[model samples]
Target: MDVFPDFDGMRGIGNLQSVAGALLMFALIIAVLMLIVCAIVWAIAAGTGNYQIATKSRNGVLVALGAAVLAGAGVTWLNWLIDLGSRL
Candidate 1:
């Protein structure tokens, strides 16, 4: 009994590595854009003495940082899982 599912001839799942790479690239780009926007908002809010807006923008920055970290780690984690599965 094979533990790993046969991926051969699976036309629908075309080029998984390329797909994953593209998705990760997109995620990183989005995260960076979010970070830039958040930084601008925070700066503007602070300059205007709007503490509420500043705080919210700070939170947005954190969320964007978290997303970037997760996206970067996700690929490594997925590779590790695949290696572990193959060893089973």
Candidate 2:
């Protein structure tokens, strides 16, 4: 019988789409909170409160957000991989 070469690719594409959609939703929520925090940080920096503090906080937020997204994607991918393997 004729057959598909890469079942994993199909699963991967689905994972990409699913993760991206979830990320967009997450981004909307993150945007609201980050908007306020970022503004506060910038204001503090502009007001000469602590330049390094503002920079460090900004970097921290980025790392936190990135970690969250990466965790989400990793979980999604692993779940999909397990499900796919089960079907085989």
Candidate 3:
């Protein structure tokens, strides 16, 4: 049995695509901003001899980096999956 997405069978898909694109853009922007803020906070905390805040901010930085990477790669990942499915 052949299984694949029927993009043309859906209505208002263009709206959904636009919304998805906008959301991805917002996510990337937020992730970058978070990364910057977290890095600054980590630096300040470390410089002030605050290990607790420094650790937390360090974790935040990693999380923000992950979020940014995921957001940036999500579209390419999805497309790759779709292409693989079509070949199956």
Candidate 4:
């Protein structure tokens, strides 16, 4: 048996999807911007011999990278889940 979601079974689903997509885009943009800013700051801090700020900026860069990755992976993960569900 095949199982699939009834995307049309509910009202406002299209709007919800649009909103979610917009949010995902916004998040990815912000994450990439933060990553760039953090990397620059990290380089500047390291050059200026500020170990404390360099460490913090490095952490910020890592967090931003994680956020971007998660945001991008969410779509792939969802699609995989839907495909798996449809095959069941």
Candidate 5:
């Protein structure tokens, strides 16, 4: 361990926050790409006249996205419920 630490020349919150914001942007980019790919595959499969096949494929994509959204909401709801119960 060095005796004296260098706190000098430290770039503060702005630099760290920018890096975190960039990571969030990357996550959004990945989500958008996934949505686009899912839509495209669904479209191609849908071109086939097999109604069941297309419906299942579309449903699969919707279910995946819905699960993500619902999972997020569920966590928030569970938190709220915990808070509500604790007050009772």
Candidate 6:
């Protein structure tokens, strides 16, 4: 009696890989766009001597960068964690 049933038959699932790839591409594009926008805002605020706006824009840039980094690493990290858990 196997506690974890064999899932070998489900290896050839639907087009999930393609879908995940597309979504990741979309997220990267959006993150890049947001970064550009934040840069523009920061530049404008700096030129206008609006320290508050510049600060906010700087924060936005950091957040966008963090999001991009997380998005890129998320899948690999998740897979690693799952593998570790299975070994436990």
Clashes of 6: 0
How do the residues 9-49 of candidate 2 rate in per-residue lDDT, one tens digit apiece?
Answer: 55465666667667755765665566568657867885887
* Per-residue lDDT over 35-66 for candidate 1, one digit per residue giving the tens place of the 0 to 100 score: 99999999999999999999999999999999
Candidate 2 regions with alpha-carbon error over 4 angstroms: 1-48
For model 5, name the residue pairs that clash: none
Candidate 3 weakest ten by summed lDDT: 79-88
The sequence of per-residue lDDT tens digits that candidate 4 reaches over residues 7-58 is 5566664565667667888888999999999999999999999999999999
Clashing pairs in 6: none
List the candidate numbers ranked by TM-score, top first.
Answer: 4, 3, 1, 6, 2, 5
Worst 10 residues of 5 by lDDT: 5-14
lDDT of 6 by residue, 1-88 (tens): 6587565644533354456556766787788889889999999999999999999999999988888887677656655655565455
User: At residue 10, what lDDT does model 4 achieve?
Assistant: 60
- Model 1: how far is 45 from its true place, Å? 0.6
- Cα distance off (Å), candidate 6, residue 17: 1.5
For each candidate in the order shown, give its overall lDDT on alpha carbons: 0.83, 0.66, 0.85, 0.85, 0.60, 0.76
The per-residue C-alpha lDDT of model 5 at residue 61 equals 72
Candidate 3 TM-score to native:
0.76
Q: Where does candidate 6 have its weakest 10-residue lDDT segment?
A: 9-18
- What overall lDDT, based on C-alpha atoms, would model 4 receive against the true structure? 0.85
Q: How close is candidate 2 to the true structure, as a TM-score?
A: 0.47
Poorest lDDT segment (10 consecutive residues) of candidate 4: 79-88
lDDT score for residue 78 of model 1: 64
